[model samples]
Target: MNSSLTLRASAAALVLTAAMAPAVAAQPDDPAARSTIGVHARLLGEKIVPHKLSFQNTTVGGLSGVDRDPCSGEYVMISDDRSYLQPARFYTARIKVDAGGVHSVDFTGTHPFLQPDGSVYPPASAGDGKAVDPEELRVDPRTCRYWWAQEGDRPKSASEPVIQPSIQFADRSGAYRGQLRLPPQYEITMADRGIRRNKAVEAITFGAGSRVLTSAVEGPLIQDGPEPTVEHGALIRVTQQSRNGAVLGQFAYPLEKIFAESDPSSPWPPDTGVASILAFPGDPSRYLVLERTWVAGAGFKIRIYDATTRGATDVRRMDSLAGQRVVPMHKKLVADFADLGLSTVDNTEGMTWGPTLRNGERTLLLVSDDNFAEDEVTQIVALGIR
Candidate 1:
């Protein structure tokens, strides 16, 4: 979550991605999560920005995706605003953190993303499925340009046009560069096929050694089956592709079950899905996968897993995986916010690597999408890792 989004109705946050760490001595004040294998991570600090903080005429919230800009040393955060409050855009931010704690998180600037026509995307009210819902975004370290994923609108009625999801490339200045070709599975036609709206491409990350950029749908395809239930999890495809959108490999990721029951009288239903994924900076086959589940009265349960494709099946050619024999990626729990004792973890999505500690341990940083809600918060948390 290149970057992340969230799924809270009040915030309407559908968080999309976190990751890196080095080993070192622990601090007495740090809260450590489960660490049986892979590596261990400890909380370093957390800082909350005012909800709906205003900046440059834009509401400074709904940050669904984030990445460290190797070119500017600033963190690039994408807001899933859908052009409601402003044009589709991303903001450059500076977050200073060390072993002791996070010193500060500052917004330096914001850039409006340009559509292919050299125009800003229209708002959802403009309809005809022309609005953009920008989710996870990343910097192509090689080109210093930006790559982003958006969960385009699925038609709510026959009067509404289908806005197919997209993965696109933009320059540092927010100009359109190009677009990656999406797989056919992304094409919607029937009622029970293709991607589910708001559930398409929520996670993306480039592999460690190869130019294989990987992307994942937030939930399952209509044909794949239903969403996660309390009794059983589900499956979503994570695609490995080239920058030009050439399909390289695709594997099924096993989504965990929703943690609790929803409120029968509540208007909103429960949900569980992939919030983000970060590839191991050094290992092409490994990643830190974050899964977030929301139960009506139970709130959000976020879990980071050490996932690998070492023995998973490539389902790029399969039409449906409902009952087929397939090996999904193997996963192990790395950390859980529920276990770390944070005051709250609402719609926490985007995450990236921060500065390495003096002890040689690398740090991981996370930011949340407050959905511009006054009760929610724009939060940034840091963790020390090895």
Candidate 2:
């Protein structure tokens, strides 16, 4: 289903609450599991002033993905603005964290993502093929360059054209360097069996000493069964590629049902998908997958699942997953955003590991995309992980 439709449905039932309460730790299913990581999230008491954090002469909102620059203490965030409000761009910001929790967030600067011809994306209009829908951003651990994902647009009608999804690299200054050559399965086609609209590649991460780059689609390809529902779940492919863009392997990750039967439903089944993925600090095969959902009247539901491809079957060679016997990654629930007691969870989409706090624990940061709506707020929350 289209994300814009989901957002519009959710906005109709918006309910505001007080500040978020401290998060309660969730006990792992297995107390002695070393392969799994336990996490507890607490909403930062102070926000970055929703839809008002400006940098480089633009209001910094619609943050979809965020990662901390290893070299600098600053954090980089990608905005999915699609060159509507401004040219495609990213922003650098400072996030303060301590024993209590995330203290504050401040914007430092913004840089425009350049096209091959060395120009910012032109404003969206008819015949505008240069515009991009930037989704996730990551700083290359090897060269400190920035790699971001674009969930290219899918056509709405027969006359509308399609955009191909891509993962491109940019210098620290946001100059276009190159892009990864994606598999043919990811291409948006006029055929019915392809990436659903607004549901292309949305998550990307570098791991294995920065030798391996992994990207996951926001939902299953049209041929891969159906979108997850309260009765049955769906499967999405996670592709691992070399830094130079060669496909290495691909595995399946099962998406849980969008919502329970008791929860609210809309004209369309509320969509659920992997919003972001992060490789474990020392394990290339392990990752923390953030899955989020937005049901019309029920609001949002987000969960962090610790997943491993250690023994999962590689499906890269398979032409279609619809009827294949594939082994999915092992996943365990790590944290549920609802348990954090947030007043209202907006469109939470991005996640990354922040600097270690003074309390000697690893910090995890999650950001929300307010969709640039006045009724919603851009929220940045921090979680303490042991």
Candidate 3:
């Protein structure tokens, strides 16, 4: 796709990956089992702290894609080379961490994980690629493969472009394996935006087995408005169809109506919620959704929802994270590596849960993209999940 569309699509899709935790409800007297507004509260107001796990500066200058292996407790971060508007290289790193909040990340090697073929068995960023702005990363334990989703568009006309988010995979040992173009990638067709400029897919992750979950950042329509431009987001599940193939399911979420602005003076941007969503590990019926908001006092808001409830159950205040609150802990901008050193990159995107650390505490990590900005530095930060 063209530069404007490329920038808009990527920006809209990846903007809400980092979170500003909100205030949590007061804890009940009985610490074991307390209920708040029909939701159970446990470990509320616990003095939890976030320590840096590992930070690495890739040669590509901007990190966009991230995937964590459950079995090995290792993470793979990709530094996307979007400056030349070409296929981005994948920078793989093996992360080691302890519950005491000590983290170490080793840069394994850099490699291209896509081939020109329509199949996914070979890894090569050969010909037939526009700008490979890789966005989504998923690791499958059942099959022992790593999947990367490329965010870009292909077109039938100059005026109209068709953007189909594509995905490919690799093995745990860091082997360039196969690539798979999303099923009926054309199913997300936008007839008006030409054959190419119709849709933009961003965040992606894997579920149980061949099941994959992904999101389309916006709807087919684009409207001009204030600085905080609004767009649509969708959630879809894809299952394997062949030996190494997949098919899209009918179950897709159109988030336009999910969190619409209720008051005209609310000042909340339209189509606010719905950018990145992750399924609850043990429960297939629950999901954690990251809602994008750039308004005053609000940067990134993450909420937990019961898949059955179909509504936001709780919200986290990641910006003002103090251990005082019982429900949603808050955090502020302590340090952003990009702004601290690298000047060219800024937009923070890409988040995933790593294995548990000290005292069986799980870890949550977020990655930011420099967008190939000349003065910005790309970084990855890890936090202790409560």
Worst 10 residues of 2 by lDDT: 2-11
- Point to the candidate with the largest TM-score: 1
At residue 351, give the lDDT of candidate 2.
88
lDDT of 1 by residue, 131-204 (tens): 88898898888988999999887887888888888889999889998888999887666787888877888888
Q: Show where candidate 1 strays beyond 4 Å.
A: 1-37
Two-way lDDT contest, 2 vs 3, winner: 2
Please, what is the TM-score per model?
Answer: 0.89, 0.87, 0.55
> How much lDDT does candidate 2 score?
0.77
Task: Judge candidate 2 at residue 39 and give its lDDT.
Answer: 48
Alpha-carbon error at 67 in model 3, in Å? 1.5
lDDT of the structure predicted as candidate 3: 0.40
Task: Please write out the lDDT profile of model 2 over residues 204-282, one tens digit for every residue.
Answer: 9989989999999999888776777665567788999998889988988877765654343357557689999999877
lDDT of 3 by residue, 1-386 (tens): 00011001121222221122112232223221211112211111111111222323334545655777666566676555542433355666676544543255566665554444423221123324444556666777576577766655655455544335666666644455766655443333444321123134455555544354543342322211111233323222212233355443322232322322235556654333233445546543334333332233323222322222122122111111222222211111212222222222234456677666556555656566655655334555555544
